[model samples]
Target: MGSERNEHPYGSLKDGDKISDKHKRELGRVRSSPTFRLGTLFTKSVEKPWRLLWLPFSILLLLVQVVKERVGATPRYSNSEPFTGESEQRNCVVFFPTNGVGLGHFTRLLSIARRMNKADPDMEVVFFTTSPTLHLLREEGFAAYHLPGRKEFSNMEASTWNSITEEMLSNVFAIHRPKAFLFDGSYPYRGMLNAIVRRDDILRIWVRRGTFKKNAPNVPIDSFDIFDYLIHPGDSVEPNIDEDETNNSIIHCDPVVLLDDEDIVASDVLKSRLGIPEDEIVAYIQLGAGNINDISSDISIILGVLHDAGVWAVMGESLLGSRIEISELPNVRILRDYPNSRYFSSFDFGVISGGYNSFHEAIMFSLPCICIPNSKTGMDDQFARAKVAEDAGFMLVEENVTRPRMKNLVSKIIDPENRQSMVESGNSLRKPNGASQIADHIARLIFRD
Candidate 1:
């Protein structure tokens, strides 16, 4: 079977077909005629009587149906408080950061949580991530809970997993009683998004990023219409917020990393904490957590390049004890923490992946960077990210990162003119602390503005 011959939207014009000027003129004349204009308006005018007659009846029926459903369903408000203004009510904004492939999702949510708490100190911000990194949140004066990853439950029976997840979401809703739920992931779990709607009166906001790498895994991202607000914490250097691609109701924010200057340790403090020497030109290396997408293959080469250039490399705990000879070299030491963005002051330069949290923090802290995008992961999307920066000439980016490429890029970052160009470019972008701006958006929704 094939497409029908008359399938063209305008007409049956096929390849190599041309419309005569007379035909085009006739079509244009009819479209521009007062008769055709009046015909369209007349159609609308004729429908007005039916619409006026039935609209109120339809609204009344909807109201009655709502009353009927509420009679036996869960109460809208358990406190039995009468209808009041938005100011009187303290609302909670629940956040779901998906699972822990890397710390990007987790740290971005944590950043938003901090801003939300500060913006409306009275309102509550809750987190439900599958990562056990809630200890980081507790240290930051926020409350959070963990949900088991889908992979854990996916292995078992579907019926069993559904029942358990449904129950878990129900309990979360009952405990939190959120005014809104914000999700940050490519594929938000259906059970979780549906749970918010089931609870009723909860706005669902999605913090989705985009323009993935060619090889990025395809996560099931369907039913986007269910969300009330689709917030894109957009990249600083990438034109990632394309209207043609994303759905309506997208709220775009700039550089939504966990950037609280108060959390940034002084240069001496960070060095002392990491036990890096004062004489060493320490280079921070974080190619993501390496839990899902391992980029440790080039770790030895990268560290060797930096080491040969008289720079001690700092890494996360993932590569520290992995017995990689290069990472375990005398000049390399691990940062031993999640949300290592706070320790930006510790390093003179950085070799970072294009993960949202890592790259933006490097830009935010003005660290001259050589970005090696980790292209092998479940929606890590580092290759596309690095491509954007490289194309824009903002940062030194590498996709197929070889030892020679690493050497060249590292040397480029070391040059004063080139390093200053990258630093100035990053500085010229929208400033950090988009977390506060996002919090303001949430507050506006809560206040019914």
Candidate 2:
């Protein structure tokens, strides 16, 4: 645990006492006497002339410390490798994503970074995160740093945690000296803000997906001013709530999916890999990580329906959660792949939650899906997003899901003609992958400038 290593007297101060315990009683009486009070007042009167002289000196020392930090002073962390900008590599970009209930924020930033790298092979990409999934980023061949979440600390103040965040991130910036820094999350941390406060050399960007509920608590308005660019990943449905237009230039792009059309695994290849016969009817079920709400009952009901219908079911296990316990059956299987959308085309149809990434991915891939929106989220209006797809004949929405409703929907979706109609609607409404477009924009802003 970091507790032993980070043990500091942050909350253990005792009025700056230095007197020995043995002499404390006599000292206390002398301090409390009227003579002591008179002496203190006399001393203060005598020191008044020198107060102005010492105050300026103290303020000057504080100013010097602030200036040192603002000017990219040496990082305080032992592992820091400060960037000297003398290496052959340049055009670096750093991505910072907060660990959400699932992989929403992390996947979005990873998608953009992938496209950017594909476009500019020499562009250096890095990651700094509090998410526990550092292994996945390393698997993708990206350099990443990790900071444990504030909850990991025992009885530490939020301010202290943020100070740690600031130091760690500042060290990363010192090492990479990125040309641009992108953050993908709803709320930006104070530590993150402080880390980049004086880094005018880099372009600050915010990649915030939009679909927040009207009454939900949102990111602070002034926080938007800190970024030079804000990219709003478009939603399927236009939100009914009025959006404030006063923030930094908001770059509205189409839904950002991780994989492009060519990137999707061939249906035959995917099916063969999963050991499914070519003739079997397969359904893919992917609720979220089951962190914010219980999804076990829902999964059980869907599995039962599929089993009854003789449909081979493959459940997507979230990387953030422990393995789900499922009753072993010949037709049921579990997939632990990150970016499950690569195999979306292999499924006959899907039963998925209405998250921004998965919802748009199902549409982008033309996979006729049943959108079982998770409405327990703090801000996402999943029902609204699903309803838009439903209205457009892209898919069906099951808000209060049950066996009968799921079975009926499954029966209708399995019909060849109905499935084709849904596929056509999706194909007709599909936008070009927004991840590549955003990558192009980033290139133009950083490389071309």
Candidate 3:
């Protein structure tokens, strides 16, 4: 947490140091026009003259004002400082989750927030997200602010969308004045960095799970300097990538899961609710949320195997993408559920992709699953995560996925002894969910007397 402000673009300027041309332009442009409402600096400035000589004097005056504001923003909290209990009255923490191609980011943050609130009932948690699953948040009784991603707007340039993000997110901060800010995503957006600049009042945190491939692009080093803490949720296999000193306090915890074992419904009750026969064996299938119509898709192959093997199937459909449609297949049901781990008890085994959330959930729940890792995901090394489980004899990984191979794996998984062995192994290796540990840490930081 004792990071140098020099690493940031807006870091303190010295007597001999030169101001970057970009910040000067930003100050001028934001002052001259009312549209650029990024930080709290809203003072009006004179229009630029036709003569270039006036530029130096104008920049000098603006720099003086910015320096005064920065001084006010940099007030350090001393140990002897009296606790006013101001934040307790507000008692809010803001969570920002990027709308990735999947719901991994949103769900992980949700898991943490839920634990935080449960541990401290007085804490009010709010979400500021680009995720389309605001309805899901509301159902969980948390207020969420939504901003559509750049892809959602037709013909809008990325810069313009970022400007909108900065303006809207800044407004949210003004309204809530949250005690802390937590973001879970691979890359921190420019707008996010701009809006959160010099907010020394709020404890800023970033949650980044690792398992990236070698070719993955690195996040900006300067971006890492902006946060007070970096929390890395652990993976089954520690990623092969090297970790650098990002100058922020880093905390490593066990894998985060949304639901505990007690949260799972009883198998008989869950089956009855789904209109499934109590005597039937069920397999839960959740590949990715890609195009389902492709006949050669993995889901199709798995479905064919299940049908032939006479096993009932419950397919997990995601809430983010388009609805999955298929002609009626007997004894096959489609469950469009959020945090599908709640239903893990009803299924005998799972055929799931090795995304962070699903793979971790399967292991935590002791659900014997055959993991088929998705190779195309940007940062998550799904294969590496699955290989760790496979090597530990807790699960199986089928990389090539053929009908014969899948059928054989499915048959092997459903055997009573094999399933029991996998379950026992996973139970031995299981760790307490990281969400509670993170939640308690946050409470200590914000509520310490």
Q: Which ranges of candidate 3 are over 4 A from the true structure?
A: 1-89, 239-242, 291-296
Tens digits of lDDT, candidate 2, 360-403? 88988888999899988887888888888898898899988899
Give the alpha carbon lDDT tens digit for every residue of 73-92 in model 3.
32211112111222222567
Where's the lowest-lDDT run of ten residues in candidate 3? 1-10
**Candidate 2: regions farther than 4 A off:** 1-89, 239-247
Give candidate 3's whole-model lDDT. Answer: 0.75
Candidate 3 residue 221 C-alpha distance from true site, Å: 1.7
| Model 2 pairs in collision | none
Error of 1 at 391 (Å): 4.1
In Å, residue 15's CA in model 3 sits off its true spot by 33
Cα TM-score per model = 0.73, 0.79, 0.80
Query: By TM-score, highest first, what's the ranking?
Result: 3, 2, 1
